[model samples]
Every structure is written in C-alpha cells, then in structure tokens.
Target: MTCDYDVVIIGGGIIGSSLAAHLASEKNEKFKIAVINSTGLGMPASEAAAGLLTPFQLNELENPVRKDFCFKSFEYFPEFFETITSGSSAKHIDLGYRQAGSLYLIFSNSEFSQKENETRNLKTIEPRLSFLSKVEIPKYEPLITRDVIGAYHYPSEAYINNPKFLKAIYLYCIENKVEFLNTTVKKLNISSNIVENIVLDNGQVISAGKFVFCNGVWANNFLKEIFNTDKNIIKAIRGEIICVKALHAMPLRKIIFCSNGYMLPRPATNAFETDSVLIGSTSDEVDLDKIQPPLSNTVSGISSLINLFKTLVPDYKDYLVSGCWAGLRPQTKDNLPVIGKIPEIENLYCSLGHYRNGILTGPFSGKILKDLILENSTEYNIEPFQINRLFETQIRGIPKYASI
Candidate 1:
C-alpha cells in the first residue's frame, strides 16, 4: 500500500511543529511530513506562552527524572533557538530571546528566609541561584515596590517571544517542504494495530506510513475514542495572560515574579509600538466538556492578572492594557509529558502532555521524537515518559472506530 506521506503529525503547536521541522532537517532520509490542525498554528498554548526559560521550578519538581528533564531542556535552549533562526531571513521578527535572568520577589523576613532556603537547595543544580537582600533588590529593578523585602535571582534564566519562535519553526518546516493540512481529524483508520489513514471532518481521507498524536488537551478526545474508555489521559489547565505597555518609559529590564503572578518584558510588537511587558497568569483546571471556546480570558482572570502587576510594580500603575488572552495547557494525571511510541500499535506514536513546560522543552522534545522515528538512541532519559508507564496492559484491543 502506498502512503501519501511518510509521517502525519496531528497538532500545529510547538511540540508538533518542532517535530516537523526536525524531520524536515534530516539529511540522510527526507521524510514527507504533513501537520494537521483544527485551529491555526500555536493558537492556544504556544502563542499565548509567556516564554520563561528558567528551571527555577526545579525546586518544585519532586521526581528526579523530571528535574533532570527540565534542566536538560533548559541547557539545550540556546542551540535550539539558534538552529530555528539560522537560515531564516526573518530578521525583522524579534524572537525576544534574552538571558537577562529572573527575580522572584519576597515580601517579608519569613518569606525571605523560606526563599533563601529554597535557593540554597536549588543552588546545587543551579549554581547561579542567589538571594538578594531588600537593599539589593533595587540594584536589579528599581521599580519594585518597597513591600518586596528581597528576591531569589536566577542569573542564567532566559525569555523568548513564544509566538515568534513558533512562527520561525513553522517557516523552517515550510522551507523544508512540510505540508500543513488545515482541518480537524474526524477519526483514525485503525486496522490490526496500525493507523493506516486519518479521516477528516470534511470527509477527506489521507494515508500515511506513521501517525503521531500531538494535539495537546484535545488528545483526551482521541484517546477516549480509540481506547473506548472514559479515562482522560490528558486534561486541560487554562491559563490567562494580559499584555500592557509602559505609558511613560520601560519600567522593567528583567522578568519579575511574586506570590501573586509574574511580569516580564515583552518585545515591543506592532500593536504596542513601544516598550511593553506581559503580566500573568492564573492556572485553573476546567472541565474539558464545559469550555465552549476551548480558550478565552475571563474578566476575573484578567482582573487578577492586573492586580498582580499592580502589586509587583506599584510605581508604574499607569500602564496601558493592550491585550488579554488565554490558553489551555495539556496536563497528565502524573504531570509528566507523554512522549514516544504507543504500546501495541505499530507505526503509531505520541508527543503530548508537556503541560507548562511545553515551550521550554518543545524543541528538545521534537529532537526526541525524530530520534525515536529514526530508531536512533537519545542521550536524554525517556523511559519515564513511555505510554506503557501510564496505560500498561490496558491497551489490548483495536480502537472502537471502524477500520478500513
């Protein structure tokens, strides 16, 4: 049987698009790749991401494997950004990558002490981590309110313009001849254990040698349909962000964080036309069945973000609200990403569920997927992210859908 393409990746977000770009970059064997998406590229999470590259969450991650994964992805970012931008003539596009570091504000002596201990523990892996005293906080950010007693600074942390980064990867994929199909997948043609073809909502059928599910929160729908189970392997966590411009002059030079939320310098876009910053976010888990638009910012969510910004930078309370938006992050029961081949299904795989770390880990995740498809060994530990780790013997029979 002849296949229309070598691989068909489902999802246009960073994870899937990065995988498409990686496959397109292969010199030994050029894979004919097609990316299918219901919405436009990076509509939900990818474009809406605040683009923080700090591994400070390392202190919060209990799993050793996850800690290493986060750190490795953090270390791999510089090269990944360069690789995506090298040949593209899109110099006009500001990818907004900067290594200016991040500061987590501490409000009281007790909070400072707690954060000091936290930074000390994190210093083993992140040596650059340090605590700044109340007097020293002004050295990095003078605009921080006096309520901030101190802060923990990660000097090597970076930030990027997520939408621009996604666009760059998408352009790279197009330059490498990757086809993008703009439609929703209706179902999979599963027969005897392999996904031979994908049926679209428009009644179109496309054949492929292999199928990869990367559709983020919506992956739960496909999983339920294929496994004929009510278990939601991947769930949606909604986060909202608001963009504001500094009416007078730029008030921040580095990313600032507090207990409420975070404010980071956003590269001035055509909409702002001046120095601006992104203040966000609120993480609230919503029932998948209830979200009509799937992604949208609530008035309360926007108000909370504005309050967070005001608390962080009380001196600059006169900022202009440019835009507000929301996105759904794909989370798993265990909170680790689902990458690698699916159990019992030949020529089928998944690269989903990176959750909050999708942007930070996306390019490397793509590398992992490319290596898996090509049967090449990867240096990073991927055993913890396998399908059987979650599904086990439950993946026994063919999908409930009709087969070709």
Candidate 2:
C-alpha cells in the first residue's frame, strides 16, 4: 500500500510552489513530492501582483493578529529567498526585491491632517514613519505630479517581482526533484476520513500519502465536493493591472499609494532593459467558476489605471503602454488566510484564501504547513487561520472591499 508520492500538492501558484520548496528543503529525509497546476505556472494573481510589500501603510497594522502575521512574513523574505536560491538555477533570477520604501499620496489638507496624527502613533511601532510635505515629496520621487498635497512614508517597507519570486521557488523545487504535473485534480478519493488519492481530469488515479490544496479561488469547489457543504468559504476577487514603460530611463524611487490605486517601480533587470512602472488594481468580486485564465483587461479597468498613472506621475503621461492583465485573488469571509490540516480529513491539508498577502505570507505559510504535516506542531500561532474556525462562522455577504 505504498503511495506514488509522499505528498501531492494541488495548485502551482506561489502558495503551492512555496510549500513544495519547503518540503524539498527537508534535510532529514527526501519526500516524493508533486505539484499539480490546472493553470499555467505563475499564471494569475502571483504574476499579476503589483508586488508592493507595504503592509504598514494600508491599515494592515491596525489589527494585532494580522499585523503580527504580515510583519513576520515580511521579515522572513530574505531568509526564504536565500534558502530557495542557494542551490537552484534561479539564483541568478532577479526577484526585483527592493527596499526603497512606500509612500501614500495625499490629495487634500484634511486627509493630510488625518494621516499626520495616524503616523504619529504608528511611529512608535515604526520609528522611521513620517508624513512628507508636498514640497518634500518631490525629493523622494521627482517624477510624481505636482498636484499631490503630500505623502506618508514608511522607510522599511519593501517589494519584489512576484513572477520571478514564484519562478525562483519553482526552480528550487525542480532542482530538489519535486515533480510538477500540468493538470487539474478532478476529484479526491476519501475513505474513512482520510484521503487515499486524487483523481485527475484524464481519469488517472494517483495515490499520495498526504494531500494539500493551495488552489486559491478554486478551493471553494473542492471544499464543496469534499465536505458536501453549500456554504461559500472562498471568494474570488478579480484584479486588473497595467504596465507602462518610460521612453527613457526614469527610474522610480519608491512605491506610490493613492486612493484610486497604487504605483510601483518595475526596475530594469539588465543594462539593456528600460524602466517601467506597474499600476494596479481594480477589485471586483466574481463567481469561482467565472474566471477562465488568460484574463483580459477591460477598457474601464485600463482607463482607471491609466488615470492613476497620470495622477501619480503626470510627467510620464507619454510613457508607452507595455501590457495589461488580470488575476483572481482568493479570500475568506473573515479575510484571514486558511493555513492548517483539515481536521475532518486525516491526511488532507489546505493553505488557501490568502487574498492580498499571498506574496508576503506564502513562504512562512508554507513553513507552517510543512511543520504541521511532519510533526502536528508549528512555531507560529496559526490558530486564527484554522479551517475549523471558518466552518464555525456563518457565511456572510461579500464586503465592499475584500482586501486593501
């Protein structure tokens, strides 16, 4: 009764790839691991993300639990990347990791006053946090529009190239002999509260000692299929982003945050590469099944993003439009990520509903899940992100804003 693989991980996005990297990095024993992706590698949200790692600016630090979760993940980035890139071919991959800091633009005096007080208190936690005057904003980012009144700056915030980060981890897993199958899991074979194996779309049955679902928005379908519940646990929030390239090298100094959207520099990886900026996003709730990958950007979405670009850097209005794309982010009713073993299914686990923090939290979440899979214990307190808590809470209507 030997299993084909020690672990079969469903989904190949950042979450799944990070988990694969973690499992592959195990020093004690080599586990037979497989990562299955229905969509192409790094297809949606992972690649489509603006890659802005500004957890402190967006009311993320308001909640103690969420603040701790995000900050811990933020601090773990260097070590996570180090571990994955140590022996992999992706060591040379430019993950676009930047610590240039993040700025939140202010349009009015009232808004400035409000943030001034907010930053005053936040400074206790982040000593470097400050509100830059309109006269001083240009010193940090000269390309910005003159219409901006001021901005709130968090010097320690950082960002990364989401796609390359995913690629780095994928390569690490491949280098460690983790198998990747580009296919969909059609069903699961559960017997007496334990998952025996997974059934693929082609009717191929693959046995595995353990199963982990990191399929993002698609987890809802799997949940309903496995638990036989009609409740909607995971919601798909579609986001659209546009990339604009400057004719000349107009390097952006820091990430920009505005009421309408955000702007971040997409640094040139090579000498021949030109400077570009990524502007995002519009959040629209869509049905789980409604999203077919290769998502297109709408005229309205593009126009809105363009307006954001113009408002942020009016001087860059003539910049070339390089590309536009969309992605679906998975979120739970509570907006906290789900990361733990499924109590009902002995060998089943999940790391879904990451929403906006997937890029920031993926690696640590993977570490936590890996610990739970091996020893049923973890260093971090994931009690708030448990799956059982989701089932205990009643389903609620989708909020006006899913994630910030």
Candidate 3:
C-alpha cells in the first residue's frame, strides 16, 4: 500500500537517532523517513547513559546474541564517528573524543577466569583486545590508587561527551533531513500482521510502509499483543551514577571499573580545572515512573562506589562530590538485543531489547537495521535476536501488554 513515508520509526532514543542519521546519510536523496517517540523518551535512560564504548565481550556462553552484537557495533564506531562528523560546520570542535583505551579492572578470580576465556575467544575473532598484568596497571593509569589489581585494557576503546554526541546526532540528522515526531504514540494500528497506522496521543494518525518498534522496555508490552513473548526478552533495568569534581586536579587517564563501580572522567571545563568524574553504578530492574531516588537512597547507591574506589584508587576519597542521579537500562532476559523483522508482523521490524550494553552496541545496530530494511546482506548475523523468541518467553509465564 502507498504511504506518506517509506519508513516511520517509533522511539526517538539513541537507536532511533542512529538509524535516522544513517538512513539520511545513505538514503541521500532516496526514501523519506520519520522518527517518533513517547512523551518522555528523551529523559533519564538515554540522557543519563554512561556512554562507555568498550569492545570486551560479556557472558558469551549465556547470551551469545549480545556478545555478537557488541563486537559488531564496536568495530563500526571509528568509521561511524567519521560519517557523523564528515560535513559538520567548522565552528564546532570535536567534543571529548577518547580513543585512549578502557580498563575492565579485575579483582576476584571468578571475574578473571570468565573474562580471560572471553578475551581468549575474542582474540581469535578480533585481535583488538589484550590482557594487562597487575604490573601494567600503574603504567597505563599512573594516578591509579595503590590498591589496584590486574585489568583487561582495550587500547582502541573510545568515548564521547554524552550531551555533545546527542546534540551532534540531532543536528546532523536534521541537516541531512530526518523528521522527528515528538508525540506520545498511543497504539499501533495493525491488520493482517502488518503495521498500518500509528495513533499518537496528540490525536494524529500517520501511516508508513514499514514500522520499527525500538521502544526499549516498552517494546515487550506491544510485542506481547502483536507477537507473544516467551523468553525474558526485554525488562526495565534500573541503574544509578554519581558525578564528583575533585579538589585536586587528579583525573583518570582511562575509564576506571572495579567489581564495585566505575569512575569516568569528563573533559576539563573552567568550573572543573582537573575535570569531573562519573562514579557509578548499580543495576536493578524496576519501572521508571515508580522509581525515584529517595534522599536516603542517594548515599545508598554510592556506598558500593566508595568501597570499590578505595580498592581501585585510594585517592578516590580525596575527590569532592559534585552531583548524583539515577538511570534505567532496557535489559533483556537473555542480555541481547532483537534485530531484523518480527516473525508475526510481515512488514514490522525492531532493533530494541538491548540491555545494559546498548551504548557499546549502538553503532553497528544502525547499519544492520538500514541494511535489513533495504534487504542487504549485513556484515554480521542477526538471527539470534528474532522477535519469535519473545513468544517462547510468554509461554514460560511472562506478562504481556500492548504498546504504551
């Protein structure tokens, strides 16, 4: 059926932005596109992301789908970042781009054994990661506290200023021309297993040739109605972080992670001569609106960081507290993201259900989604994330709802 646009993407989070940006760049003068989101999709989760871009694979044995996607996305950032900044106006300088490296600090033997095996297997597929001995830790981060232990350092791991990156994508996409629909999508109108129209909370109805339900935790609700879920595909996972500005100018050389928490240093500002540090975070599952940090909880979420920092970097105690906040991550039961078309919906597709590692997997997701929509062969396989798995999860006793 003819429609106003070639594609109408739901959810304006990072995945939606990246996809729109990529389509704008690739489509050039071709297909028209639009991005839609909920009343508050830009709040919390996407805005508060730690924005870590490490390439280290996790829980491969338990969820190879995310492991595969993480590696695929990590490999795309270098060129992806290039594509993003290619035609930006000369007035703006590149913001907080860190190609320095990242350390997955290890203390316990269990973490060591698990990471070591994953690193070894990853080495065969990607020669990008290497294990760092305890002695090497001090050399990489000279300011590292004396209590530091052995860590796995990914030298090519890069990072960006979260706010700046978000703004850049918005600007670049607009320049290249991607329509953003800022309204709450009430429901999806479907018939014969195809998305026909989107009914927005604002009383507007829009139709398109294809629909991508990349609505993070909200995906399960609609997927349950559209396609029954069986396995734990997408769950709303909560996390928190604290930002501290140090009295002394001692900032971290690389992103610091311990079994307890992590400390990421922001680029220096006049207000922050040395720089600000992001020490976070705690992982839990809860609804966003129901979850607000009580004053008592402020000191609670940070307790882990305080203890871990003392062990990873003794000097952590010397820093002054700047600010603190909380965020939610769309965690999947299998800890992987769903890509490609939905089995039940003929022309409907999704790229959501990415858990904690969404930041690490954002880039490759865009390319794959665009390629899939156009029916092009992708560099990596996406069969592991099919929405059909959600049907299995529903059979196993998971609650289902409609698009929120």
Candidate 4:
C-alpha cells in the first residue's frame, strides 16, 4: 500500500508528542509525521500527574530495568527541557521545573531500621541522599508534625509542572512542522502482521509507512480488537488527586512522601496566584467497562488523604480545599512499561503502560521508540520491556505503593 506519511503516531500525550518532536527534528525533515488524538495534549494521566521526577524512589529490587530506565530519563530532563524550549517560539514557558528534593518519612522504629540498612546501599546509587533524624527533619520542612521518627532526603530528586511541559512539547512539534489530527483511531487495517492503514472514526482511512501507539490504557482495547489477542497487557488504574491552597506561613520546600500518600507543593505562578499543594492519590483498579469519568469522588479517598495530612503536618487544617480531579493510569500487570515492536507485527510499535512515572520517563521512552523506529543503536537494552514478556509469566497486580 502507498503511504501518505512516513509515520502516524496515535496519542498526543507526552510520549507521543516527544516522539513526534524527535522525529520531526531529524535532519532534512526526513519523515512525514502525523499525531492523532481523541483529546488534545495533556489529557488523562499526563495532565493529572504530580510531575515528581524521583526514580530512585521506585522499587529497584523488583523491576531493576524500569528503575534504571527512569533514572536515566530523570537525568535527561534538564537537557530535554532546554532543547524543546530553545527550538520553539514559546521561549518563556514555565515548566515549574524544580530540584527541591524529596523526603520519605518513616514513622516507626522498625521502618527506621529498615531504611537505615537500605540507606547504606542507597548512598552508592544516590550519593547526595542522607538520613535525617526526627529533629533534623523539621529543620528541612518546618511544617512537618513532630511524629517521632526519621526520614530519607534525596537531594537530587525533582519535579516539573506537567501541564505546561506538555503544552511546550505540543508547540515545539508544531514549530518543527509535525501535523496533528484531532480524532479517534477506529481500527488498524493489517495484512500479514503489518499495519497497512489506520481507519478513523470519521470514516477516513490514513496510510502510513509506520505506526506507533502511545494511547495509554486504550491500547489494550485496540490490541484486542485488531489482533483478537486478549493479552491484558494494560489496565486502567484510577488515581484521584486533591488540590488545596496552602495556608502555611511558609510554603512546603520539598516533596513530602509518607506511607499513605505524597504531597507536592506548587509555588504561585503567573497563571495561578495562590500557592497550592497536591494531595494524592487513590490507586483503584476499576473495570475497564466502568472507566468513564465522573470517576467517583469517594469520601473515603478524600478523608484518608486528609487524615494523612493531619498526621504528617500539625497545621494540615489550615490549607483550604481547592478542587479534586481524577485520571486513569495505564498500569501494566508487571508494573513495567511496554515499549517495543510487537513480535508478530512489523512497522507497528507501542510505548504504553508507563503507570505513575509517565511524565518522568516520557522523553526517554520517546528517544528509545525513535531509535527502534529508525533502527539506530541504543545504549540501553530494551528486551525486558517487550510485549512478549507478558505471555511468559502470570501477570501480577502491582501494589499502590509499589513504586514509592
């Protein structure tokens, strides 16, 4: 089949946008690229994330490959932001990029001992990390409650304003001449395991030499519909976050992580005047059929977060509730992302199932996908993230705090 474009990327989230930006920026504008999305950029999880970039907090013992990938991606953020902002007309975009560090609070003596043992090894991986005693913890974050215990402070960790970053990438892609179609992909017309064309819901058939799916949880349905393979690779895990205006005399200086949940302090910006903090999230693995929004704002979820805040900070009652929102994370069975070519399909690729760290790892995932598409050599081995691995073992449910 003759192709209209060299590549058709489905999904306008961060991953897809990053891939389009990278591919469009190639020398000579070699490839014709189109990005298709049902909703515009930052829809779903991309916009609803806390934008924490601390990969070291993930469970390295269980999924070392994902941990390594996230760490490398976290390291690439500074340069990635610079490149996207420098190339686009939107030079003054504020990404809320901050290296304010993260504190993982410990509440019990047993937990403190465990962290102490882990810290010895963590120092080798993250040299700037330190174990702060209960007395020292308040010195860093004065608002923290005097709940008798210690904490681990990772000074190298950081965060970004995810929504702004997504917008910047979209603008950067446009500046680089990447076309975008605001539509839904109805089907993939495949013959002999090679996708020949993509059928849209509007009755338009688009042809592309190559196709990449970055559509998050929707990819599972797409795969089942196209291949008739019920490989349950991606599941939608709903996470609800609450945003509140900070009432503290001094704003939270760093990311605060506790056993129950974590909070991110977003400083006042030109767009939003009041300094606010995000308290999240409830990871509920709901049935895909019931995944539609009005994603139930339960009293239990909100109350749990409130109680956690009260436990962590004495002045938790001071912060007034602003609003609450929810997004479905494309969590994989193994808690690792699916980011490679399908074994049975040629010219078809996937970069989905990023779960909680999508924003953190999206750029590096894009680079990896680009390298795979262009057949360029990559420094990291991506074998562990392949789709075939799901068939090899029983898919396990990831705990809510597995990555924390």
Candidate 5:
C-alpha cells in the first residue's frame, strides 16, 4: 500500500529520533516517516543529564519496561555507536560511550531496605551486579569516599555522552532518510477519535498514518486538551548539576552517590580528567512554567554534594567547578514513563515521561515505540507505562514529590 507518510512523530528527542531510526532500520517496506521537535533531544534535561545507563535500583523492581529497556539499550549501544560514528573525524564528537560500569552504594535506613537484596537479584536487574565490601572498594573505586560501606556493581550499563547520543540519533535518522520538522506541534488534527494529522505552530498541517508523542514534561497539557483525557502522566521536576573539572582524581569509576548528591564522569573534553565530574542534582518537582531552576539553587546543590563528598572522600574539599546548570525531568505519578498508543486515540502513541531515564531507556524506548507502530511485539511489556494508568483514578489537589 502506498502511503503518504507512514508515521508523523512529535518531538525529536532521543526517544522520537531513536524510534525513527529503529523504524527505518526495521522497515520491510518504504516508509515516509517524519519527526518533529520543539528544542530537540539533549537540549534540556536529557542534555544536562548525568547519562548513567544502569538497571541499578533500590529494589522492588521499578517499571519493568524501563528496567528491561535499560539493559537492552546498554547492550545495543556499541552497535549504535559504530553505526553513528562511522565517518565522523572528530574523535570526541563520536558517540561517547564508555562501559565503565556503575557502582551503587547503599546508605541510610530506607535506602538500605530498598537496596538490601537488590544485589542478590542483580541477575534480574543487571546480570553483572556484585556485592562489594570495604576491602574491595579500593580496588574498584579508589577515589571514592573512604566512608563507603556497602556497594554493588553493574558492569553492563555504560555511561554515555547524552548530547552526542542525541546527535548520533539525528545522524542515524538523517542517514536512514527520516525527515525532521523543526517546529512545535500545536494540536492533534483529530476527528472521530483518529489522529489524521498534526497542526504545526505556524498553521502548517502534516499528515501521518501513525502519530507518536515523545515530548517530555510538555506532554501532559497536550494530552489533556487533545484527547480530553485528564491523565497526569508527567511530573515536571528540576535537577541542578555542577560540572566541576572533576576537581579531584576521584576514586569513583562509573557513578558515585552519597546522601547529599551523586556524581558521574563528564563526556565532553575538558582541561582535566578529574575536572570533569558531573555532580548533581537537586530533584525538585515543580510546575511546567517553573521549569527553569535557580542558579543559586544549583550552586548550593553542588555545595551540599561537596560537603557529603568531604565526609566520604576528603580529597574533594577545595575543588573548583567549571559549569553549573538546572534541567527538567518529566516524571510520572507512578515514577514510570508512558510508552504506548492511547487506546482512546488510535495511531496516536506516547513515549514520554521518562524523567531522568531518557538516556538509560532512550534507545529501547525508541525500539518499543517502533514495534508498536509497526504492529510487532515489543521486546518487553508495555503495560506498566501505559499513558492511561493515572487517569484511572480521579487524582485531586495534592502535590507530589519526584522519584529517581
């Protein structure tokens, strides 16, 4: 069947772009697919993210979709990297993927409870997770705070340069002949409960057989009004981070976290290896209009992290920071993303509300969204993150907190 366009995807972030790439890669027939975005991927929270792709969780097994996709995507990065950086001469610009593994430490009561048997079920979460004691700490994480008592490792997950990852998707999409429309979608041109096309900000209309909404944080308002569905699937949260020229040699290998803050290795080239530790972030849930967080808040957030680092690793006491920022993460009420087509709106899908896991689950999120559009079985279950889950209940006026 000759179709005008196979799909019209909204939002060119990691999720949308990845989906476009995956769809084209898996295309058995010709497909005219287009991806639209306001600011594109890695622009806000995704770009400012620590880019730690791990299945490491505090137990109870978070959204199964996210967990499964995280591991799947981790295994998929090497190939994705090769495909995207095949011709780029610039070394650092090439997909910055490093399988440094992740080190998850357990501290405090609630934190301990959640992480207690997590390592035991490490195989379920991540096959490579192993317990580490004080003695083994130095061998693994030499620069980490000496106060670290309990920890585990997940070697499968890789730390990514998120911006490059997004760029790679852009390259992959362009390479695959996926069209990009750099505009915000005003509304779904829906009639009789079917999304026929999308109205752009400038009144230009584009048609599609399948419509996927991958815009984070901004999806809620769109959903409520477009479908008249009051499902609160996205929670806007602000995260503050500081790029301290890794300030210290830093015993941390993959990702390090204490009570106050967590840090990840920066990807972009910097003056010093120790100078590029991406220290973050204050997880403050706020309204969409209040998306931009305060710089003072970012500074204080870094300071708090420094204080905690001092207690854990005294070497980071007088470190100098290079950059500081705050970004928004689109969390959901259930702390899981919504990643399937809305039953109410046929051919209209959603892969949003990923919050901090956009980098971790970005690739797989794209993979699954592709499967849904192509009518193939997804690699993992999609029920957990169904967009309609929250709307099942009448959630009234109480504010909620963000979950990591």
Candidate 6:
C-alpha cells in the first residue's frame, strides 16, 4: 500500500520534533516523515518550561520506574544537546545549556533527616550528590533564605534555555528534510484495527504507515475519540512561572528547589537582554467538567509563586518582575509517561503523559520511539510504559473501547 509518508507524528513540541529529527538522521535508512502541529512551535509546555534537568532530585521510593527513566534520560542530555547543536542548521543556536547543579532545600529537622537518608540511598544511582548543613547552604547559594535547615546538591544535574533548544531542534529537523505540517488532526481514519489515515482540520486526509501521538495533554481527547475509550488517563496540569530580572548581579548561580516549587536562572530574552531568574509553579489539574481550559496566567497563581520566592530567596524585593506565563503538563494517573505502541491498534504509537519531565526526557524518548519504528529494539525495557497498564488497573470499569 502506498502511503504519503512512512511515519506521521502529531505534535511539534519537544517530543515530536525530537522524534522527527532522530528518524530523519538515521544513517542507512531513508524514511519520509511528517510532523503535524495545530499550533506553531513551542506554544504550550515546551515554551513555558524552565528546562531544569535534575532527575536525581526525584524521590526513588515514590515512583522508582519513573525516577529510573528520568535519570537515564537526564544522562543522555549532554550528548543529545551536543548532537542537536552541531547540526549545520543549528550551528548558531545557543541552547544556554548549563551544568550548575540543583539545591534541594530542607526546611525542618525531620525533613533534613529524611533527605539525609534519601541522599544516602541516592549515592548508588547518583554519587555526585551530597547533603549540606544549614551553615554550609549559604556557602553554595549566598542568597538562600536562612530558614533552610539543610540542603542536598546534585552536581550532575543541569538545565537549558528551552526556547533556544526547541528552535535548534526544529531547524535541525527541517534541515534533515523532515516536513512539518501546521494543521490540527481532526480525526483518525481507522479500518480493521489500524489507523490508516489522519484527517486534518482543513479536511485533508494524510495516509501514513505509522502514526505516533506526541501531542501531550491533547492526546487525552485524541485517544478517547479514536479508541472510544472515555478513560481520562492523561489530563492537563497547568503550571505558571514568573520571570524576574535582577537589579544587580544574578540572584543565584544554581537552581534552588523547595517542596513547593523551584527557581531557575535563565538567559535574558533577546528583547530585554538582561539577567533574569524564573520562579515557578502551581500544578493545578484542569477540571474535566469544564470545556478545554485556555492557557492563561492568573493573579492567584502569580501570587502563590511570589510567596514561594519570598520563602526561598532572601531579599526577594531586589528583583523586578519581568514577565509571567503558564503551560499545561500532560500528567498521567500513575505520574509516569506513556510510551510504546498501543496493544490493539497496530501501527499506532504514543509518547505522551510526561508531566513535568517532558523536556528532560524528550531526547531519549524520541530515540526510543525511533528505535522501535526502525530497528524494533530499545536500550531500555519499554513494557512498563505500555498503554495497556491503564486498562489493566481498571477498577471503575472495562475500557470503553475494549474489543473483548
């Protein structure tokens, strides 16, 4: 059967673009690939992200599978960032990649002891991290609030200028001859058990051998419509960030993280060209009862972030507010990403539900998906991320679309 392309990837965010780039750059194989996005590049999560790459900070006991996945993905960033930036079209792109590490602040004595144990256990996976005394905390971040009882430093962690990184990857994908279509996928044309065609918003039908959903939170509705499964496996969690420029030198050289949220030092935008710090965020799950919620900054969200800054940074008044924005993260029921192919639907694959770690895991997930499509193998076992697990734990009822 002749198809328009070998693969049709929906979504132009980090995951979709990365997959497009990886597939197009395969050494011996040439496959026609197209990336379709309703909105232009970086409209939602990818643009509003702070690009913190600290998977070591995750609590292993909480969700070990996700933690392990994040650590592996974080380890791949250095090489991944280098490769994407080295592309001919991406030569001038400055990703603002930094390995300055992250400080997880401890607030109470119990919290300090808890983190001490956590850091001790973390040494097996990440030996570069070390716990710091309250007195020693100021030595690392002079501007940290005195209320900190202690802190843990993950030296191997890093961050990037997300906007520039996305731009570079997008340009690199285009340079590699990956076509990007700016249109919304209205529906999936299915026959038997496979998706044979993608219907666009403009009533155009695109046929492809394989279809991958990298549309993040939007995938929830897409999956529901195509499979007739009403399960809300993925939902949008809105996160808000406030950008502040320093009046003097930069606030801190490293990322400061507390229980509530974290602060990131980001490169100044081209428009302003000033030193800036990013304070974020509020994880508000979208009310499923409402119509699709528009991504917008709210006064209450900004105020909550301001309170976080006041609690974490000393002399927070020294910084002037620059800007604020919000993005929706595709959070899953188990808080782990959904990867691999759909069980019943042949040639249908998904790499969504990344929540907050989308940017951190984007490169590696892309590589994994590319391997699955080309070599039919993966470096990491992807069974744990299969979409079937969502149906396996179905206490409410069987999946609405279950073919049984």
lDDT of 4 at 328: 78
Question: What lDDT, from 0 to 1, does candidate 1 have?
Answer: 0.81
lDDT tens digits, residues 1-404, model 3? 67877888888777877888888888864688888876554353566777777656254565655665677787787777777777554126555778867788777688888778777876776576777788887888876765535888777777766656766777777787788877778888887666788888878888888888777776766765654433335777767777777777567889876656677777664343457777777876775445444312246677776665566666766788776666667876566678887665667888886666666666679888988887645767777776555555435322232232
lDDT of 6 by residue, 180-235 (tens): 99888988877677788989988999999999999988887777765456667788
Q: What lDDT score is found at residue 199 in candidate 6?
A: 90
lDDT of the candidates, in the order given: 0.81, 0.82, 0.70, 0.81, 0.69, 0.83
Q: Quote each prediction's TM-score.
A: 0.93, 0.93, 0.86, 0.92, 0.83, 0.93
Model 6 regions more than 4 Å off: 27-30, 40-42, 269-272, 288-293, 392-404
Question: 1-404 in candidate 4: lDDT tens per residue?
Answer: 46889999999888899888878777345568999988732346888888889886774255767778888899887878888989897678666888999999998989777767766866887888988888998888888877867889999888888888899999999888788999899888777667889999889999998999999877877766544455566888888888878776578889998768898887776764788888888888867775455566678888887777777778877889898877779987788998887656667888999999999999988888888888745566888887766653442321111222
Instruction: Residues 30-59, candidate 2: write the lDDT tens digits.
Output: 679999998642356787788877778646
How far in Å is the alpha carbon of 5 misplaced in model 4? 1.5
Kindly provide the TM-score of model 2 when superposed on the true structure, using C-alpha atoms. 0.93
Q: What would you estimate as the lDDT of candidate 6?
A: 0.83
Off by over 4 Å in 5: 1-4, 28-30, 40-42, 61-66, 76-79, 86-93, 106-116, 123-128, 229-231, 246-252, 267-275, 290-300, 376-379, 393-404
Clashes of 5: 11
Model 5 TM-score is 0.83
lDDT (tens digit, per residue) of candidate 5 on 24-111: 7877446788888876323466677877766564345576555666667667766656655662332346355678877776655576
Give each model's clash number: 0, 0, 13, 0, 11, 0
Query: Candidate 1: TM-score?
Result: 0.93
Off by over 4 Å in 1: 28-30, 40-42, 269-272, 391-404
Candidate 4 ranges beyond 4 A from true positions: 40-43, 392-404
lDDT of 1 by residue, 173-290 (tens): 8877899988999888787877878899899999998889989988887787777778788888888999988777655788888877888998665664677789888999988787
Cα deviation at 198, candidate 1, in Å, is 0.2
